[model samples]
Target: MYLLSKALIFPPVTEADDDGLLAIGGDLSVERLILAYNSGIFPWFNQGEPIIWYSPSQRMVLFPNELKISKSMRQIIRKGTFSITFNRHFKEVISNCKQMYRPGQGGTWITDEMEQAYIELHKKGIAKSVEVWQNNSLVGGLYGIDLGHVFCGESMFSKVSNASKMAFIYLVQKLEKENYKLIDCQVYNNHLASLGAKEISRDSFINYLNKV
Candidate 1:
């Protein structure tokens, strides 16, 4: 398997050879980091492994207006039971994400270094988090970076089956109110697809990303 070379990106839509791999090593400097995201690439690797970047042919994203909330979920929203907050308790949210293990999924990849780095970005207002609280306990949340009008979601976690969904629903509403353009779901998965995230060609994605 091959790997990315030095965090450098290939053509905007063209990814490095996918030998089940791409970049091998690189620092996540703020400049390179933002550039990578703008080009439809994102860093994801196991702890202790060199930073790897990926830009698959198909990208998953959510348009705020395109979100689909089910009838039952709508009923939950009517109760107003879960409280949503922004940029509050970011550390807790991330920690929970790191701890939750999905079935058949590998262990947490969000490392301490990554955590520290994102926290710095958050302090600088480049990153934001949406948290869900029930009965005074934080059961679900997500975090991501806000680049201009695009919100690049990183990860989320939920202890309750529908808790994260509630957080996502509230997040979309907040984004719509703020007039933010898109939510970069990063990769397609059954969970995200259920939330109405769709796949778009990488070129089209970068076109919209460049506008933001």
Candidate 2:
């Protein structure tokens, strides 16, 4: 593992440890965050810990064409019960994500500093958010780093059942229309798997990142 200095650089992803921890102690400046996502590395640590960077050997990703929408989700979409918007209410979306309680997790990885950092990224138009609303109230949403051809998904949350899925489905459809190569889900989980996201070798993922 490596320790990051003030310099805007990261060790090669190849040096990451078995758990994908590549480095620690980096600041989350907008420039560094942009470079990190473009290079296929991202920060993921709790609030009290030193900033940890990871480049997992197995990457979770979804090709826009491969996104799966279940029958119930499709029905909900057709009913027009939820509305979706991009880059709208970003801060709110992320705030909800920060406070959201996961099944087994005790704390959130989206620290206050991390929140401010990504907000800066949003100001620069490098990061984006998708908001899901029901009757003008924000219920679910997602946020990520947009690298043109490849979107590095950071996190998402839903207040109502399937609200986040609605946001995701919309984002995928939009990206597909724009010919995006893939959505980088970072690590794997059953939730993403159900949506057709699968693990690809880090090498393969880096290849996608290298696409011009």
Candidate 3:
């Protein structure tokens, strides 16, 4: 693994391990974080662990045109069961994401430092959030980096049964209307697969980021 220094540089994605861990020991400065996303790399490490960068050989992504909304989700959206807003409550959304429990995960990868870093990114308009509300109360939301034509999704959380899905669907429809090219999911999971997110070659994903 590469040990990053003051220089904001990263080893090639090809150098990543079988599990997609590319490098370690980089600080989460704004400059480094921006550069990382632009180059198809992202940091994912639990608290007490040195910041770890990854560029998986297979990247999970959702092209706006391919977003899948099931009948149940469509019905929920049409009913306006939840209200959606953009960049309205980023800190709250991320903080909730940090506290959310994930299956097979012992703790959050959104460390305190990571939270502060992304919060700063949000202030700069590089990071954005989608909030889902019910009965005037915040229920679910998601946060990610916005690369103009592509959104690099970091994490999401749900307090209700379909709150997170509502946030995601709303975000996808909005992005589609805005002519976005893709949503970078970072990794594959059944949750995303059901939404039509699929894996693509890292090289192909990088090329898309470069072009858009």
lDDT of 1 at 16: 49
Q: Write the per-residue lDDT of candidate 1 for residues 1-212, one digit (tens) a residue.
A: 24445545544346445432345566676666767767677778879787767777677899999899999999898998788898888888888888889788777788877787777777778878999989999989999888878888999999887889998888888898888888999778988898889988777787888895
lDDT of 1 at 6: 59
Give the poorly placed runs of model 1, Cα more than 4 Å off. 1-13, 18-21
The alpha-carbon root-mean-square deviation between model 1 and the true structure, to one decimal in Å, is 2.3
lDDT of each: 0.79, 0.94, 0.94
Question: Estimated TM-score per prediction?
Answer: 0.90, 0.99, 0.98
Query: In candidate 3, what residue range of length 10 has the lowest lDDT sum?
Result: 1-10
Candidate 2's C-alpha runs over 4 A off are none
The residue-by-residue lDDT of candidate 3 on 14-64, one tens digit each, is: 899988889998789999999999999999998988889998999999999
Clashing pairs in 1: 3-22, 3-23, 4-22, 4-23, 4-24
